[model samples]
Target: MKELYDTISLQFTLKDFHQQKPNLAFATAEKQQLIALLTYMRDVHRYTHLVFVTAVDWLEENRFQITYMLHNYDIKADFGIRVMLDRDKPVMESIHHLWEQGRVYQRELHEMFGIDFPGSPGVNEPMILEGWQGPPVMRRDFDTAKYSLETYDHRPRDTREPESHMKEKLYPED
Candidate 1:
């Protein structure tokens, strides 16, 4: 892992790099260099399988972290590439060319996190929250309780003890 890291470090300008486990590591790079870095990893490092693409809403830091998890079957290792995007304008380059499944993840991130992958197919279309007019619910600032209360109809709870309710059901004559 260290040797692989060293090799990558020499080629790309990584902001941060750390090993989570013997076989798993993560590296953060600038958004501008993300596509190139990923390309190099896929081409040179043989990290051919793209396991997943996900995002973290760093509300306090005013940024969004997009992570791409890649796996190398031959080496039995996993590598993650992280890129931080401006919270105000969360945009990232689409990796659909390298991995076709990237489009699905990009579309999901676009809907859930409001991130933009300009060339990602069907990115503008809704994934889960179809025909919805609300803020991105996955964002930290999105008040889920408030949205639920406002958007959904609520009914008062039935205030009854479970034991008594069971007793009533068991002994109906009483």
Candidate 2:
């Protein structure tokens, strides 16, 4: 970890989440420096496996925090690369070069959080949820319960039955 810190010390800030272990994270000092930082980690540190990518909607800060978790089996260390994007503009370059699975992660985040991966292939395609319309529903700004109430009829919990076929067969209810 210190080796990486020493290399990009000027372009990135190395953060140790805690003192107990060397679990390290690097936050690019500038958005433009993110690709360079990620490339350094992949080529030099051998953190080849991109476990996952996700984003957090920082409503109060009006920004989205994107994190990429990478693992190096040889060194047995996890390296995280983080970038913050403006909530309104929420776009970043794709790290598909480092790991192919990144395409799917980018697509999901783009759908749910409305973050864009500018150069990624198939990133704009629909993923799990489909045929729906609106601003990213997972954004902190989107009120899910409110939207559900407004769009669909609500039923009281007490008035709803379990409706389980197994329960009927096992109990033989009257």
Candidate 3:
């Protein structure tokens, strides 16, 4: 595992490495570096499984964090790489070439968080929502209450009905 870390570090900047557990994390500033790292893990280090991809909204910093989780079943270890992107123009390289499941996850992330993954297909297609407007749903900037009020026609329910047990009580008239 140290050898793997050394090799990857020599080629790119590894933000963090953990030896006590079976997890490693890498951070890169460039999309090309992320692609290269994933390719190396797949081809050289035998990390053939792409688990999932997700994002975190850092509203204070005005950036979104994208994370790709990869696993090597044979070696029984997992790795996660993260990249930060501007919220206004969030874009990153797609890892679909390395794993097919990445395509679906990337597409969902694109629609939910507005993070763009270059070279990914069907990113603009709707998955669960139709005619979505305003900021992306998953981003912190999107307000669920406000969206519901605007998009849906809600009405207050009446609570004037008498209680069912009141009719059977001794002081029912009161």
Candidate 4:
């Protein structure tokens, strides 16, 4: 891994080595160089499969972590690449050329997490949450209970129901 990585030699850290699958994580401080690394991984190291692309929302930090998982079938090894996006303006270049499956992953991320892949077609289209009208649900700050109550019609709950139920259950011995 080190010899192959040294060829392109963009500064990246070995994030984990002891796990069942070793992983090297790259921070997106140099986002442009990431594509180059992916190309080398695919063409040279033969990590030809793009397993997945996904996002994680960190509400406190106001950032999103985007991960790209690539698999090298010949060696049975999986590699991960990570990039952080500003939650307010979550956009990144798409890896559509390297792997066609990236379109679906990007599109789903856009719908669920509000991340955008400008270069990937259909990324903005509704995929999973076909008619979703609320803010991105996957974001940590999204209040799902609030959205559900407001979006869908349901019978109002009794305000005293919780108190009565708790009194009966906790004091059953009484």
Candidate 5:
């Protein structure tokens, strides 16, 4: 695993090396460089399966983090490549060229987070949250409470029904 990391580090300019208990992570990279790295992993390293792809919103930094998780059964380890983009203009290259599953993830991320995957098919269509406005819900900056208050009409709880007296009065209701 170290060898793989070293090789990747030497080949491309990686921003950071992060290892979290069970997973290894790499920071953001330029689009072309990221494509090259994914290509190398798919063709040379034989990481044939793309497990998943998702994004995280860093409200403080006003950025979105997109992570692609790849796995090779033979290697028995997974590699996660993460890229950060500006919140206002979150765009990244579609890895669908290398892995077909990328298309599904790309669509999901597009609808769920509003991140744009240029060149990916059907990115403009909605998968969920029909007629949603304001900010993407997954983004950290989007306050759920505020959204609920704004989007939904508040209703006071109904207290019209009196408590059942059968149980308290025992046999009286018979």
Candidate 6:
């Protein structure tokens, strides 16, 4: 894997390269060169399987870190490519052309993180959250406590003391 990274470094501009294991590695790349980097990894390096696409909200940094996990069957290895996007305007190049499943992941990211993948199919359409009108819930700034207080109705229900309930259940005969 290190040897592969060494070769890729010569061709692509990558940084923060870390080898987690003999078969698992990750690297950070510029968002502008993501598509080209992904293509090179898939076509030349034989990372044919896209395991998943995920994002991290770096609230303090005011950026969103998108990670694309790819797997190579022949080498039994996994590679992660990370790209940082501006939190103010989270937009990324659509990878649906390379992998069909990318559309689904991008759609979810769009709904949850407010990331935009221009030209992705049905990206604007709601997937899980239908009839929902609120800020992107996955964002760090979205207050769950406040949203729940406003969105859901609080009802009083029967409650029990843990010690008494457990004692009754364990020593009912007594």
Evaluated with lDDT, which candidate comes out highest? 6
lDDT of 2: 0.78
Off by over 4 Å in 1: 160-174
lDDT tens string, model 1, 70-119? Answer: 99999999999899999998889999998999999999999899999999
Give the range where candidate 1 is weakest over 10 consecutive residues by summed lDDT.
8-17
* Local accuracy by lDDT, each model: 0.91, 0.78, 0.79, 0.75, 0.78, 0.94
C-alpha RMSD for every candidate: 2.9, 6.1, 3.3, 5.2, 4.3, 4.0
Q: Which TM-score value belongs to model 5?
A: 0.81
lDDT of 2 at 173: 65
- Per-model clash counts, in order, read 0, 0, 0, 0, 0, 0
The candidate, 4 or 5, that scores higher on TM-score is 5
What are the models' TM-scores?
A: 0.90, 0.79, 0.81, 0.76, 0.81, 0.89
Q: What is the lDDT of residue 123 in candidate 2?
A: 84
Candidate 2 backbone collisions, by pair:
none
In model 1, pairs of residues that clash are none
In model 5, pairs of residues that clash are: none
**Model 6 per-residue lDDT tens digits across residues 87-121:** 99998999999999999999999999999999999
The numbered model that scores best in TM-score is 1
Residue 39 shift from truth in candidate 2, angstroms: 1.2
RMSD, candidate 2, Å? 6.1
Give the per-residue lDDT digits (tens) of candidate 3, residues 17-41.
5555645544443455888888888
Number of backbone clashes in candidate 4: 0
Q: Worst 10-residue stretch by lDDT in candidate 2?
A: 11-20
